[model samples]
Target: MKIKVNSEACIGCGACEQIAKDLFEIGDEGVSKAKVSEVPEDKKAMAQEAIDGCPTGAIQGEE
Candidate 1:
């Protein structure tokens, strides 16, 4: 799976980064960014958690 952060929608609340630092991060622009291009099999659940936890619904997952 691939994860994407929509900069326009992100609030930079850090919920995503807190959920999965390996997959998401707060960028210099104060928006969440996907650190990985693809989610590892073992980390897919964590990525999903981050997506669900995003208050602004900025994260999107693509299978």
Candidate 2:
């Protein structure tokens, strides 16, 4: 699975960070964005939860 983040829609709420700090982070611009790392299968659930927790619907799964 691939995760996509809409930078324009993100509010940097840190919900994704709370769910999966390894996968997401708040950038200097304060937008919730993905970190530069490979996502493990164990953290997939948390990643999905983060995507769901995004209030602006800025995150999505690609395939």
Candidate 2: 10-residue stretch with minimal lDDT: 32-41
Tens-digit per-residue lDDT, 1-63, candidate 2: 567778999988888888888888888998877873446778788888988889999987654
Runs in model 2 lying further than 4 Å from the true structure: 36-38
Q: What is the lDDT of residue 42 in candidate 1?
A: 99
Per-residue lDDT tens digits for candidate 1, residues 1-63, read 999999999988999999999998898999989999899999999998998888888999999
- RMSD of model 2 against the true structure: 1.5
Instruction: Give candidate 1's error at residue 35 in angstroms.
Output: 0.4
Candidate topping lDDT: 1
Report every candidate's CA lDDT: 0.93, 0.81
Q: For residue 30, give model 2's deviation from the true position in Å.
A: 0.7
| Candidate 2 TM-score, C-alpha based | 0.85
Any idea what lDDT model 1 has? 0.93
